[model samples]
Target: MNDKNDLERLRIQIRGAVQGVGFRPFVYRLATNLGMVGWIKNSAEGVWIEIEGTRSQLDLFLLKLEQEKPVHSLIQQLQASSLVPLDESDFEIYPSVSGEKTTIVLPDLATCSDCIRELFDPNNPRYRYPFINCTHCGPRFSIINALPYDRPNTSMNAFQMCDRCRTEYENPLDRRFHAQPIACPECGPRLEWWDHHGKRLASDEAALQAAIQAIQNGQIIAVKGLGGFHFMVDARNSDAISTLRQRKHRPDKPCAVMYPSLAAVQKDCELSDLEAQLLTASEAPIVLLRRKANISVLERVAPNNAYLGVLLPYTPLHHLLLSALNFPIVATSGNLSNEPICIDEREAIQRLSGIADAFLVHNRPIVRAVDDSIVRVIADREMILRRSRGYAPLPIALSKPVPTCLAVGGHLKNTIALTIDSNLFVSQHIGDLENQATLKAFKQAIDTFEQLYEVHPDLIACDDHPDYLSTQYAQHRSSKFPSSQIFPVQHHHAHIAACMAENGLEETVLGVAWDGTGYGLDGTIWGGEFFLANLTDFQRVGHFKPFRLPGGEKAIREPRRAAIAVLYELWGEAAFDRTDLTPVQAFNAQERDILQAMLQKELNTPWTSSAGRLFDAISALLNLVQISTFEGQAAMALEFALEHISTDEFYPSVIHQGIFDWSTMVEEIIADIEQKTSGAMVSAKFHNTMVEVILQFARQWKQKRVVLSGGCFQNRYFSDRTIARLQAEGFQPYWHRHIPPNDGGIAVGQAIIAASQLLKRGG
Candidate 1:
């Protein structure tokens, strides 16, 4: 006790994902074990600690702190200096300090192994508890109201801890120590089951049983989960799936299934090492897997989709609900078509009443609506299809620090991003801002992020598309802030930039952008594009030849119209009578005449080089999809057509003057169909042709790093094939893994691109 001469005190501040992840408890255990007196606490900036210890002990403490930090805690910065000691007698954790929060908020984690074991353990107090969670797992961002993350500011605030749980929370050696969302059945939220008419059916165990019974009875139930509600039904029930699809007005969009166990998932789908790892990872994202031929899963759940989107039960409630049933449930987002996920209990019951037969309700309020994150293995690596719930709020690190900025994202798959210095915090998947409710949610997200991260935008970025709600949001932002700058980024450019930003690559690279549509600089619609790009600039090096859409937006929904345009371009008047051109057979004489006139006069017709439109046209010509019920339905069908096919043949095309001439390919494809070519061979060759086109650009640009992005890349066949071909040609092809390759990931690119431009202007 009298070793004062050798003793020292230090005030250390740590930043980065250091909150809601047991960081303070980690420090407490380490300090107490080392016989050091200290007080640790969470703050807006990060963790702050005051330690008094001998020189050698302090040195050992620092070493272990770096080497043995909490598994989920990522220490971005740690600053230490000698300071006056508080003369503390024992290590302790003080209440979190609130003000300007900079420490990262943790994403909601999937059930940890220990928690999973305790869930099923008969001897455990929390056995079979629907809300069981601990420090290592359970909800975080989805439940957080604000940060300096603490129970008082989360959805868990209403659930006061019982004595035993409180003791565990206060004990540094216990795993639940300082866990914000810690709860057990005794002092936690309970469940309720309600009929569509708002009559309560049952409670607790009975409620769960009723929910499962409803599903087994071929009824769709809106079940509350971690982030929001999910529409649940027996995956094997074709009638229920069709009924739900009809009620939801989502005729062909694939529904995600939640299996009870890993064994069940493996039995239904072809699993690979990477896919299996991703499915079971802490995020517990829905992974697209090749479905087994003999599985009882109804095709109605995912018609024409080559891969089934599947996820394991990630939460205690999910585990319990799945445990009560023998079959997997279709756990799709609780929203109509393109609406933001439903979070409020009453709102869910009201809005989803038409689609869901019953509601599996809960008392705990969700702070935000988060759709389940989605991923797929492409070229043996993970590619995020949708980012939300279990993989959000945690910022993506930039190559260097930049000023505060906000990006409002695209009109479809909207996700807003905010940057404070080097950390780029992209919000959870905000649904397409087409409806008032979704737009309100998007606005709320902007406000919430501004308050949470405590940063005002120096600039805002969005798409150049004038009609996009995101563009309007940015315009309004500039007007409201007055001093804020606004950057209107091209759509395809943003798609490519997102992948590049996530990879932290600043150098110029070859970017291949293909999706439904983007506003081209020359007053035409663009989608198939190749660019030589860096953060600050991009040069359009190559693109698909523009073709007119017979009825503009109408052509997007009706693939037959796009096919008519392609055929009209190819054969003029002769295309209408071609007996092999079967898409024409689906149209009436009047409709055909009107479509032909629309194409000839180019009235209400817009030209686009979109690879997506091309896919739609090809699918229509083959009579696979004459009219689409969903945005990518035709393209999805085309990808599905590749199943059980092996071919090296491809329709030939040429590139001249930076424009890819697909006329030869289109003409040949028509001729092949007339010659009775199989759809599988045509689909395989179509995919192969895309690979060849990308390879041509890769070779011509001479950039080793090729970035493949845009919604078109969401097709597994196209993305995987293109990536494999590029890699084999000795090019390092960068594809999206965290942010979606679709519009959901576009905001990140918009943010970084604007940041780079701002830095250049020294703003």
Candidate 2:
């Protein structure tokens, strides 16, 4: 008995990552089912909806829209207003309108359950289709070329849709209505196999079968995935694993092991509830888990590491390939030690031919190289070690909104961050920018994020260090965009601020940032630092005592140098006579005299209060590692040394005049070495000492909350124990979650601090 005049009309505007993720189709279905009349279309700004119906029906539609949004669509803001109702007849999806873009770009997602089922179903049209996807999952950042996300604006435009797919695309009733990446085996990219000689072996199903057989027969296969090529080998084959290690020149670094199912992962490693959930999450990432002692996985895969990095297949090709295999596979990035992962087929074959026996590639292009994200579960929380693949390009919701800004990250593990309105997007891991390839990748990441968001940045933030390439890049951009304000944040402070930003901490907290090196305000190198900080500023209240970084940056690769410095400070010239010293034994008399003079006169040696260097020094003293081949090899070796043992005892440490000293710890380690202390025992004691000394410092600070960040915290053995001890002391401690603890996360901190400054200045 409702009057026609009583019928309500409303116009709704929704923001966030609403496009290319089935938002419009969902709206169409809900409105049509509610017997309402409306026209829904995508705009660059967001989703716009006009609906006419009875008040009750209109009310139900709004509630359901909020409660049951599309799986991958994140609703940031929703607004509704009354509208004049004409005699609108039916619900329809209108053509996309290109307008000013202000919403979040949809991030790349793992395949959904429904789409996965469809991919494997023999009766389905997309059966065994390698590029199988729907609105709920698949490429977003990598494939997209522009906003108002449609197939024409994506790489999918290369393939014309067939009649059946066209019908689904045009019909609002279909599940894949307007699904941007929708494709079939006939209309989409096909898999092909090629030998190292560049001869084509097979195609389609035969190619996949060939790939399976190649991996089964202890051969390496470079398989192209959503982001890049994964050089895969049978994990159970120790010879295959060793061969891959030798070819890749990655001797001890752990590689990700891909299993077809949770059962397969469980067969080799113990999975906690959180770990299992993370492994099977929609944005599935590689999870680092403790290996079962008696597991049959090749020992060479992880070597001395206590944990194995494991992942379940996240793409259609992976699903199809693993379906034909029964063994876990070692899936490492297809590249040499320092280069970016291979994205192009030709590039992969050219670069990975020495490592890969055959190549399983596709015609579809990967617009960007996104590495698989790495994660570990600690203290019932998900800690992201490396953010990429499934979890990146998604905006981090800030505690307070700020103006559009960009933060160029630290030098070592560079990544860029852009904040448009309230959404903060941190780019994928853009490897060290010293090399031309990585620098190009860095530029591409920044440009890609800029183009994806259409953000005209109003502010810029970068590291304080003048020598860092990232800082220089920011300076160059600042000069290019003269109107944008530029701010430089201290490096270690940026680390702590990043921890604060991710944890939503607006109040002052005790931040203990431990890393390798950062340019301090006093023109010295600071890495092990304790600060009282909020978003705006920080005070250095406590820190590790300074030690000479002999030969400057060269000491980073030679932990023996750092050890020599510490030993010299402890026992003078007698430090060289220590019988257990490996570096002293190797050094000729002249070389030893020169090194001693350099330390004494401080020639080319800079001082560093770095916890990372301390770990390096300890590592060398223990004879675990003297010279590092990679950036973190020595420190990582130190972490792994005590992986098999548990200890509560700690070496002695002293704090005087707010300067924490590890001289006592160094001396005791030397004594332990002279007494032939076990490597595991010394390593355990060192880790425990660091944990104890930091807790003592936290007690001195008297802050109820503590924050830990920087590259040093990436060590699970260190972070886990530090977090545990802090919790025991009735103190709340915060660490990185969705972002890494290392320099990769510093951009978020820089951006946040800059934004806070802008807000404070009312900019």
Candidate 3:
């Protein structure tokens, strides 16, 4: 036995992503195995533990704790100190205690391999069970209603565990120990099949089989998922997909396909080692991969796109269903176009009745809806195009701490951000705020985050645009919190700031923000812009030449309008007679006359330097897309057309007085079109010219670090080439990886900028 002088007590406080991840059990087992006596308990802040042992024993305990923690647990902060021995006899786990909140909710995880094996094993009690989960995996953020991450605070509280399951839960050696969503078929949620008319058709196994049969018959089945619902249909069923497109009012956007396994995905798509790892990762996000040759059967799913968004089975139900079938299924969000995804069965039925023939739903209520995350490999790195579901509500580490703040993101692709200490919590994709349903969902998401984090913001940040729904909401909320300060950030600045924040850059960098549109500080529309910026402030250094957008917002939906506007700006009224131009031929004399008048009188014409509008104009001139059916349709088409084509040749362009004048490039493109040049060559030349413009500016500015942001960077071809060129030219280049390059990342930028400014003011 060790002497009393050799014994010591240690008190440890650990924070960040510790709860509901089997952390306490892991600690209990470690302490007991080391012949130590201690008590561990969950707390509002994190986990608190006290252990008494010899000095060497305590040292070994700390070492093992650091070396062999749970897979999903992240120890952001840990403090251990010497204390007087409490004379404890045995290791024990005490109940959780209440305190000031500091911890964050972990993102919902995809089902784990252990659970999957148990699900399919013949002798396992949960064999073929759809709701099987253990401590290492399953839902956390979606079903959670409050903090401290216990079963009573989650939707699982509605179902008390069976005696057998309870014994496993209480056993520290078992994998299901303290797993909040732990359940078997006899004690957990069950699936049901319902008709579009709210009539129940089948339950449990029958329901799963019925959904599969309906899918094989080329019928749309709305399946409730971990975070929300998905509309599942056979990817090869062209007629069924066409019907879904027609009913959902989504004609051109590509749908994600869920294959049975990674090997299955490799057969149809070109998958790299990294891509395969990402596909099978715990997040299980939809990864855009290049399609292999001779895969025409899936053409209806992705249309003319060169890449197919693919995902593996993430949930047990998905696995059970896919394993029983040979064909892949198209899994798209279950909602009408432009609306938030539905989480409730009744809501899914009411919103998707006309589209879905049957509904496969469960009784475990999702506290909030989260759409699937979308990712792609650009510049040999993973870029998250849409952050949700398996990748959201997880805090982004910040470099510094500031006053509590809430950032209301832009109108399109809205997502709010909340700050606690040095962690930034960016919400999932909230979609466009045009409809009441989306707007209401946006508010509810904010409310849920605020409640979950217990954050009463002392400041609010929003886009400077006066009329944007997000800005208006910020203003409206400021009245409710009279003590809260409101800070309106410029739109393009937020884009750049978001990039800087994502990269943890505090120093000035060349910020290249190119997107479809943003409200400029000069009362114009800015999209293509360059700024010398840091987190707190920015200086506008360069931008594209301004051009008129005829009919304002209407021009965005009609590429022909932007095409005509560019042509008119070049040759004035003389250009209208050029019937050889596709945009000119598409518009009749009356429409041309009206457009000319709008440009001349400046009525309802907004001047913009948007790179996205420029791409739209070029697409129209190429006769590829004269009208857009979706937000990024024309631009995506432009990117698709230039996929494999390469050309070092660039068109003529000039930079004078911080303005990139592409008039000569436009003239050259028109000449190439008149000369019957290939569309690929023209697109290559245009892309080359744009890359050269940024390069020339970077050389002139003498900035070694360049940050690229905005929606234009989402084009993989452009981003990959630009990054390669920048690195070859001996410059550090940074683009978004975790956050989106679009407006979905605006809140993160706003939050960081606001926090930086507040720190400067000593707030």
Which has the greatest lDDT? 3
Candidate 1 residue spans exceeding 4 A from truth: 54-56, 84-88
Alpha carbon lDDT at 534, candidate 3: 91
> What is candidate 3's CA lDDT for residue 111?
90
Tell me the whole-model lDDT of each prediction, alpha carbons only: 0.87, 0.86, 0.90
- Against the true structure, what is each candidate's TM-score? 0.97, 0.96, 0.98
1 or 3: which has the higher TM-score? 3
- What is the Cα-based lDDT of residue 580 in candidate 1? 56
Worst 10 residues of 1 by lDDT: 573-582
Q: Candidate 2, residues 1-763: lDDT per residue as tens digits?
A: 4467978889999888898788998999899888888799998889899999998998899899989988778888899999888857789888989877776667678888999999889999898888888778888777778888888988888989988888888888787788888888778788899998668889998999999889888999999988889999998898999899899998878889999899988988988999999999877899999899888678888776678999999889888878889778898888888788989999887889999999999887788888989998866789888888887787688866788889999888788999877778889887887787888888889888788777768588999999888889888887888887888999988899888888889899999999999999999999889999999889999899998877989889899888887878778778777645875665577877888888889898898999999999988887777877678888878887887698899998799977888998887887898899898899999999998888998999899999999888888888899999999999999999998988889898899889888898888
For candidate 2, the 10 contiguous residues with the lowest summed lDDT are 578-587
Backbone clashes under 3 angstroms, per model? 2, 0, 0
Give the per-residue lDDT digits (tens) of candidate 1, residues 121-214. Answer: 9999998878888888998988888778888888788888999889988888899987888877788888999999778979988898888788
User: For model 3, how does the per-residue alpha-carbon lDDT over 1-763 read when each residue is reduced to its tens digit?
Assistant: 7677788999999988899789999999999999999899998789999999998999999999989999888899899888998777899989888777778787888899999998999999999999999998899989888888888989999999999999999888889999999899889999999999879999999999999899999999999999999999999888999999999999888999999888788889999889998898888999999999886346878877889999999999999999987778999999999999999999888899999999999999999999999999999889999999888988888877777889999999899998889889999889998999999999998998888777778699999999999999999888887987999999989998898888889899999999998999999999999999998989999999999999999999999998988888888888788988999998888888898889899999999999989999999999889988888888888888887787789898799999998888999999999899988889888888888888988988889999999999999878887888889999899999999999999999999899899998887
Ranking by TM-score: 3, 1, 2
